[model samples]
Target: MAGGKTINSVFRRLAEEETIRRVQTGLYDYPRYSELLDRTLGPDIFQVASALARKFKWEIQPDGASALNLMGLSTQVPAQYLFHSDGPTREYQINRTKLRFKRVATREMKFKQPESAVIVHGLKSLGPDHINDKTIAKVRDWLPEAKRRQVLRDTQTVTQWVRAAIREICKEPVHG
Candidate 1:
């Protein structure tokens, strides 16, 4: 394993050269410049969370609100990007926004991909009573064919109603 001092030294030099921007203590990103916006874009919160999970060797999934926001199912911008993880619960501040990891059951982290996590969590957030054909169709249309198929396969063992909703979302269009 690399020494913490050695890693910190490298990061300090990189930050000094502006090769990377520090999101918070121990988290850094190669800042993305947006020509359209004429400025450096903020670090992507999802990418930041993923980086933390990888660094800590944690299995992570976006929680309901975060997942809904990711899928465009919710219009409200989350003040905190919340994730359920096998790691200890913690919070990190990224500028005005916050990133949180809440420890959850292992079963919840079974999704094979982030896309699958988003679909499942988003549907769960909506709840059985709130979901309708329109919502299902919206989710179906939002995902590409490949992702729809993958998400369908990954969520087979999820909660029955959520699984049912995923089936509807991922079902292929029938031709007459």
Candidate 2:
């Protein structure tokens, strides 16, 4: 019964009544309305992805473009938000954007904190050549002291240059 028209009809009724909005196949969300924007705001891509991951029991790490955007290092919103996952590779269309999960080795998914994962992937994407004091400072200033320290500890196994960059970001501030 759960797999038949019963469940489908329930969802169809909910959608028809505007109680939930369909995001993609087998996904729905309580729509949020924005008064200033004067429209139903689009779903947050990360939240949607996280929802899917949780539903399907997948571990996901935000890829470079997603990390950069989430960290405020990039002004452009990626048309395709990519994530590395310890799950089957899959894609979903959310609004006008694409959410993709690329399968990877489970080892790559290891990180204690989400922030640490974001920082490491963001740094790897930027590469050693592009990392500098300004970038390090930007990341440092974004994190509270405690979070910076936590990220430092959480990212001990990352690449040498990324680990170095994190060390610089997590270092104590010098007072004159």
Candidate 3:
């Protein structure tokens, strides 16, 4: 901790002993293991991103693709875990996977409800043409009761079309 050399030496020893794993420069975690799977499991991408955002005092949200994936609206795995933040753009490689943070407008980073933000971003990734009745039903089924209610309540702050789409997804039977 006294100097870069000392820190590197300490980290290297810890890694070699499997006491801790390096995530990225100056970041480390105690690795998690699944006995049933008989393999190591990586840290949750969103949790890692949230930690980094807090460390740097930045507002952050998952980007469209990441949001879709996070909400189980998309089955495709992303090559990179992406987030939009008000901080400067940056990238990190953790356990051979890329984590990217792209700078975005202050307004885009603000959301009063987490479910609304995730649903909006996930719907944006699907696009209007892809969001049919079946898609809306899937999203509705995927969301828990409380989150469904919250998304409906939070729709007031979103744009007209987005609010309508969210209302439809929540199965409110009326868009207002």
Candidate 4:
């Protein structure tokens, strides 16, 4: 429609008809239903966040705990999914699950490779003491060959200690 009034009217109609479910103000989705489970299934939080980021023209990356969870390094599912962005801070709740976006400096959001960024965040979440040889091996094993190479190539932009850890993780064994 040409104006907010027209758009709101259309949205109201669709919502009333159950064709769309309102997640929050200005956010909506086609509600997913699990027939076997007999309950509503929540939308993929990452996909929802990505759509919002694109719609608002914001650059975002999964933050700390969220990064660890996305990388399978963390087994516990977080109640809130967090992201860092160059845009204003905002929060949204979808089906009782929370999505939080915290604003940060542009430089903080820069990374040559997304996989490297996730690994760095995950390592930071684990802290120095926890990121030993076994942790390095686990992370290396978790990543595919291409992503392992990319992480190695992208380590230059990270901190010295982090780069060292990444180097060790990427090191190839010498055969006798």
Q: TM per model?
A: 0.79, 0.81, 0.76, 0.73
lDDT of candidate 4 at residue 137, scale 0 to 100: 77
RMSD of 3: 4.6
Please report, in order, the local distance difference test score of every candidate based on alpha carbons.
0.88, 0.89, 0.81, 0.82
Q: Sorted by TM-score, highest first, which candidate order results?
A: 2, 1, 3, 4
As for candidate 3, its clashing pairs are none
**Weakest lDDT window of 10 consecutive positions for candidate 4:** 166-175
lDDT per residue (tens digit) for residues 16-66 in model 4: 998888766788888889999998777778778988998899988898898
Candidate closest to the true structure, highest lDDT: 2
Q: Which candidate has the highest TM-score of all?
A: 2
TM-score, predicted candidate 1 vs. hidden true structure: 0.79
Instruction: Write model 3 residue lDDT over 48-69, tens digit each, in one string.
Output: 8988998899888888899888
Worst 10 residues of 2 by lDDT: 140-149
Q: Tens digits of per-residue lDDT for model 2 on 6-58?
A: 99999999999999999987889999999999999888888899999999999
